[model samples]
Target: MIELEGLTKRYGEKVAVNHLTFTVRPGVVTGFLGPNGAGKSTTMRMLLGLDHPTAGDVRIDGRHYEQIRHPLKYIGALLDAKAMHGGRSAFNHLLCLAQSNGIPKSRVAEVLDTVGLTAVARKKAKGFSLGMGQRLGIAGALLGDPQILMFDEPVNGLDPEGIHWIRNLMKGLAAQGRTVFVSSHLMSEMALTADHLVVIGQGRLLADTSMADFIRENSRSYVRLRSPQQERLRDVLGQAGVPAVEAGSGILEVDGARSELIGELAAEHHLVLHELSPQQASLEEAFMQLTAESVEYHAHSDTGPPDTNGWAGGTGTEAVSGGGWGEQWAREQRKRKAGG
Candidate 1:
């Protein structure tokens, strides 16, 4: 289990993380969510003892990261895929980590095969693609067979098959009562993988709740009804004190009403209903609504309608982020390369 209590970090005048208090219990995949530059990377760095927090406490299990004799065996993390030495072979890389962490040398082969990197075990790290590097990083994380696993953008460069494998892998690990905490920009993937969510904005705790509860509370829910007897259905609903707005195409949307109740009412009125379904917003939609105010970066589309000629207009299309931690990190890397 991972615990954070009043955790805070600052850089000069800018607060990167602030007063975060939460417990990531075992047996669930807890998702960490935030907008661009909302201090997610910073928080993860603190958890690994890579960066010092200005205040409060963060622990792996019941002790600090450094206090653990074999930290990797207790908690394995994949923070940056490019963290390995480019000069070393994949096998050599894992061998070195295992040697230092008291892990068995045979475990390196097991993890390499686990990540499907056994074929490229002797290949130089520099020659690997981004996806291959990600796999290697994951293999290193699994080298210790830790009970607690933390991943940030594990699917950044993976193919669909790899994504599916990792998703099931995390679930399998959690099924064995392991603590899995993952951070990803892929909301669709997160929605499928995470059982709970921990959302933060501007370094402050925004929400920590179950996945179903988070979406239901942050997004709109309604019932859509369609019937052959539209007029009679409207009349019955009106008389029954259930206000439903016409959504065109013979569809009626009722807010704050259950589909079962609507179906029962229609049945009582002997209405021939074609459709009665409950509509709830997705995880991405709910996330946008909850963090609408907290989003530090915004993307603007073309002022005019989309070009119907199969071409994009405006200067160019940009992703919905500018100052996100990943972008900033890339910028720093470029600066360092230029300086070198």
Candidate 2:
């Protein structure tokens, strides 16, 4: 297990990572997610002892990363796939890492085969494609056959087949009871790959939960209805005490209502229904919902204003926009007081 308790990091006047406290357990794939400039890479570097923490502590098992001799034998990391010397051959690169960590030269060949770089085992790193370079990096991480594995964007530069291969590889490792923690920008891939999630935003721990629970808590589920008789359908729904929101494209959205119930209602009213289906918000939607304010970098999009209902809520500064919960409550009070 990897444990971090109140882990923090600072760069001059800026706090790169806040008091992050979490445990990465074995036998599961834990995905790390964050928006741009969220200090995800900084936290990972601190875990590997590549960067110093300003305060707090992290441990590999019970020992600090620096205190663990032959640390690779305990935890293997692929933080940067291109961090190797370009002049060295795949085999030579693994060989050097093994030598430094007191791992046997024979293990180098084993790992090269494990990552399917045996054909290019003798090729120089500089001659390798991006995909090949990623494979080489994965080979080095697996060299020690450690109990804990950490990967940052392991599928970067990989083709579909390579992505599938790497996905199965991580799951297989976790199935063997190893701790598998990875970070990725691909939400769809992360949804399929991760069983657990550690989400951070703006250097603060936003959420630490299972993938299922996180999505469920952070997203909305609704039933969509469409019919040939729009006005009649709306009246039928309203009379039945079901709130049907008139959505765009001549559709109605009913929250907290089952599709079966909506269908039955349409049938009872003799309405010719064209469409009725349930929609659940996706992982990408949930992640963005939770991290809206924490997003450090902003890009102007033509998209409309965000739906601030679900888990996103609103920032404290949203009072300026009359969106914050406290501001809304105060506004309600003044209206009641002034008889507006």
Q: Pick the candidate with the highest TM-score.
A: 2
Give each model's whole-structure lDDT: 0.82, 0.82
C-alpha positional error of residue 162 in candidate 1 after TM-score superposition, expressed in Å: 0.9
Tell me the lDDT of model 1 at 99: 93
Q: What lDDT does candidate 2 reach at residue 150?
A: 94
- Give the worst 10-residue stretch by lDDT in candidate 2: 316-325
**C-alpha root-mean-square deviation, each candidate:** 7.0, 8.9
The residue-by-residue lDDT of candidate 2 on 144-226, one tens digit each, is 88999999889999999999999999999999999999987666888999999998865789889999999999877889888
User: lDDT of candidate 1?
Assistant: 0.82
Question: What is the lDDT for 214 in model 1?
Answer: 91
